[model samples]
Target chain A: MTLLIQVQLPDGGWAYILSIIFVSLQVSVTAVGVSTLVSLPVALLVGFTDFPGKRVVTAVINTGMGFPSVVVGLVVLILLSNSGPLGGFDLAFTPQAMMISQFILATPVITSVSLSAVESVEQSVRDAAFAMGGTDADVGLVVIKEARYGIVTAILAGFGRAISEVGSILIVGGNIVFSDGQSYTRTLTTAITVEARQGRYEIGLVLGAILLLLVLGVNGLGSWLRSKGRGERSA
Target chain B: MTLSAATVSVSYGPDTVLNDVSLGVEAGEVVTVVGPSGTGKTTLLRLLGMFRRPDDGTITWNDTDVWGLSETERLAVRRRISMVFQEPSLFNAPVAQNVTYGQRVREPWRERIRKSIRNLVGDRTLSESARDALDTVGLLDKADQNALSLSGGEAQRVAFARALAVDPEIVLLDEPSSNLDPRNTAVLEDAIRRARERGVGVVVATHDMNQAERISDRVGFIYDGKLVETGPPSQIFDTPNDSRTKQFVDGELMYDVEETTNGQARKSTSVSP
Candidate 1:
């Protein structure tokens, strides 16, 4: 009975479950953080200013909102490949490569949604700020402060997109789980695929459940932060 | 400072709104511009505030041509002048911030927030400018409340306090009491009187001839984009030089109708349409 209890699978790795969860958490946090910081200023500028080619820039960002994760991964792959100009950086087939792909995938969603958020601020608020002898920058800051809750919601939406995507990470990171075992990088989605292919159904099921829980946790936090921000504003 | 506009004219596209309008406002004096609807009274106030450039004219403040100033210089001039719009225009910020807007401070806002609070809610040891302004407007108790929470008239009064907090040389009121009830209107009139007592020149655009007569030292009647007549309140009210001014004051202007068979008829006889 003890012999039968011992897992029979490719490499027979018992600690793969914890490793996959850790890797997934790392990727999700890094992707969300980098994308949020990079997109905020772009969103604000696009939302408020009127520069040359603004319409074209807006159109391009809107189109980027619907860009597929796989397409983003493919583009980054080409840029980081041996024949590509950026190949000297040696970022391909690394976690950083996955991060770059996820950043590209998530930024436009944040920017477009944030633009909508800023646009929805009342015209009266803008007029009041202007009439108070506020300069353009001052008025813009006031608008951003007024729309802070909506902007946070946009960031959460972008985070949701970045964390849930599997294709970009798969292509750019190669989903390589190291043999050293203690220091491996294998996300939940890739680990589930590897486990399921080797007929380890129980491990795959557990990993899938964890992934679902992670997504739910992120969404729940987003909703709570949005409500908290709104309550503060009203109060 | 004395404020004067000479031959000020404003046009929107092909439509002329104010034409060759000249008026002077002396320090510590209240001047009211009375007009029928669409007579460009508000446009005149905007021109005086430097918010709009005149088609052909100059506004002289203390005998200096205002139109010659650059935008930055004009903004600096505007800092010494404030306007109270017909409707209260408050920011979305808290009441304290709104009152202290356009004020410059050498310290960080967080460090200065306590000073602002003391100014808004008067200290027993010292007189507070914000508190005095609010007290004059009958909104001293509502100093801590959000500006958005005030009633329509209360908001307008708060706007008056905000203007006063800046200690401007001149205060331009665009029908400040037009939206207020009789009680609130009385409160506003008292505030205007107090502002005048503080030596701030007051220019008001109003349709209520009675209020104009009650508070104004001088009254000017605007008709068809022109300064039809202007003189002391007694002269403008009792003996208007222009027939258009008389028709407007007597409520016999026939504003809606194209023409009336009885030019002096007090009541309507028929509807053309």
Candidate 2:
């Protein structure tokens, strides 16, 4: 005779899941926010000016958009490891390390998309701004305003990328859960991986569904904003 | 005040778009440059508007050489001059916002920041000049509507309002009514007259001889990258000095030259069908 048994969540149970969700949200939002602050100005500079090696810089950004997350994970792991160059701060296997990893993954995605959006604004628009006696800085503001929708879409895309990613964050975060079964750094994506590997298919499916809903909502909002941008431009 | 282009020239690679062009518009005067297409009228207007530095010679605001000024000074000078392109190129915003754009740019940064804070708290944002300019174009009712939602005529009027809202001393118009219907054209001409009456100098570039006759205190005929002649409209239309001006006035000259290879404009005569 054989018996089938269901394994319950360890110690903190539903509270554990909530903690994991909170960690995931905290890491992803911080990463995306920091990346945007760096990426937008870089995008604007690259979008508006003609400089030496611009094509090479643009090519690098495009290549970065498709960079493998696992490779990023490995590189970040080495940098944060105890024996590595940046080992003094002891960031290894911590949420800060995970944020650094996700920021690396999100910056190029935001920059490349935003650069395209800024460049797509019409030359006439810039000319009109200049004709109004706007300085270069003022013209930059006008272009930013004009590209606001596409920039928002780019941010959402970056958020989607940072949130759904499992490899980089997992490698850096170590998917830690404490002795009390309270999550220290485990996220939905990393948790799902461990659950599936441990034969907890039901738990894995729940995490997967939640991740899918988050990504779907983000992408849907992006598409809606993109369409609205097109409509406004055409009008 | 006077805005003048003196012996100005512009070249694009091998092509000479405008050569040895000299024109000036005094306050409260209307000067129209008339020519067939591709004859450098737009290029001359661009130079007068200080949009581009002339390849040779000078643009002057009163006694001051415009191109010789520092960038900040040049921008200050530019704030007092406005140009309307052939296409309206209205922003993707409300009509009132478009009209007030020039004023907003001309404002000091501190004031702009103050207004932004007030705007965040829901204070009124439209300036009196913006409303008055919109009223000038008979589009005050459309102030809240998206600029892009307007018809072509209404859009062009809003463009005019935007240019006027800055209280510019000089206005440069480059074929503004070339794409408009007669009714829209009439409205624009009326606005031009009103601007002149308000003591603003107006420089108009057009290929329409009738429009040149209607709005001009002085008419200039440009051909083959040169100013053929300039005089009162009656003298240009009825008793022109240059044969090219006569041919253009009689509607016989049709310029199809889009490029000037080897620095020579290739003019082609229209064929009778």
Candidate 3:
């Protein structure tokens, strides 16, 4: 306990804490940003348009929401492996790989929820917009604007899932980090696991505390953004 | 400036809502369609506005068959003929935006938007043509307010303002004053009078016989999805020739009267004048 306290008193422990928070936030933000960018148009299309195989596409997307993160990690790994096609670019076992895996895991969540949000906008509003000589693009913009608050909530929920997820990032990132002598990368979850196996309970507890605080902070900001968006819309 | 519908019939499945309804409106005319509920009064206005397709009819505007046109051409025709719904149907936007909806202004007209407002509403510092339209409807004070905040009558007036802002050649009103108080109804009637004076053809659908008689130069009576009679208001109201028209205007069932009085029912039909 005394050694753990002494370790935390130094700048090294503080650096580790900050680095973990930064990596977690970077991974989460990138995952959510990419998912949001990719999912919005898909959500709008599913919500608005009618065509053949629409039900099949919707069913696939709904099925994707419950897809296991480990499976996503494995799929990405197989594609980015050295023996796989186009694997010569070598993005495996890197932060970028983790980002891609997290994005795949988060996308369906955002898409499904956003589709519901966009669908909830009244059809009367769409009719009114079209009657005013607005084109399809104009109607889409108006519907998205009216559904902005709900879409934001969907995105925030995606972020929450991305940050809290560990399985995909662990497999894809390999979360290695170096200290004292060598270079490596290590995520909060992986580091805690390694420390616990080494009987470094204090270090694992500290990391756990930091992870809890990070999740709380994310949830807090998400709620704040949702409320702010709601207020702006109502006003 | 001239709107004409010939043999217009609208059907949904086996149920026909309007059948062989022919009407014409020239510039400076206020034509009102008076009927009981579900008698195709509103459906006739929608058909004229090109919002609904007739199963068997042609709508011609100024001698041009509008129904035969392509969708784009139909939209152009629709732009020329604006509609005011029974309810307000305003957007969740400011009043100004609602009025200028679907209207395009040239560069010169864009600059004149402010000036046009002043010209339309003399001595008032009008913001835009929308404000002037609201002024025309006597709701200028509510121009900046959210459209959703309006009372039912005020919202309907806003809808009128929106229709007026487009400077349409023909205006189709479906029960415009049906949801308003008498004062608001008078305001709407006056607006209709002004619209007619400006040579804008007006076709209003109403269930109120007195209101229709007050504003309409000509009135068409629709009964059971068919046009029963149409003529000058004096002819339709004071000198109706059809037994069904008399029974409707007098608010009684001719069948019941016939059954009750047998031979005496024929006298009551002539007595409805």
lDDT of 3 by residue, B1-273 (tens): 678889988776666777898998888899999876666776777677765567898889888888788876776777777778776777665566667664533124455466557545653343366566777899887766667767888888888888887777788887789799988888888988988888888999887889888999999988766899998888888889987777777776321122110011111222233
Q: Which candidate is the best by TM-score?
A: 2
Q: Write the per-residue lDDT of candidate 3 for residues A145-218, one digit (tens) a residue.
A: 66776788788778877877888888888876656422133566766776788787877788788887877777
Sorted by lDDT (best first), the order is 2, 1, 3
Instruction: Residues A30-59, candidate 2: write the lDDT tens digits.
Output: 999999999989998999889999999999
TM-score of each: 0.76, 0.90, 0.74
Name the runs in model 2 displaced over 4 angstroms: A1-7, A82-85, A88-90, A220-235, B113-125, B257-273
Task: Classify candidate 1 by CAPRI docking class.
Answer: acceptable
Q: Candidate 3, after superposition: displacement of residue B48 in Å? A: 3.7
- Cα RMSD for candidates in order: 7.0, 3.9, 8.1
List, residue by residue over B197-232, the lDDT tens digit for candidate 1: 989899999888999999998999987678999999
Q: Model 1, A118-226: lDDT tens per residue?
A: 8887655654455555556666777786777787788778777877778878888898877756325468887777778878887677677788898888778878977
Residues B1-273 of candidate 2 have per-residue lDDT tens digits of 989989988888777778899999999999999887777887787777766788998999997899889998999899999988887988887788789889888888999888778866867557888888898889999887778889999998999999999999999888889789999999999999999999999999888889989999999898878899999999999999988788788878866664321223545535223
Q: Candidates' interface RMSDs, in order? A: 3.5, 2.1, 3.8
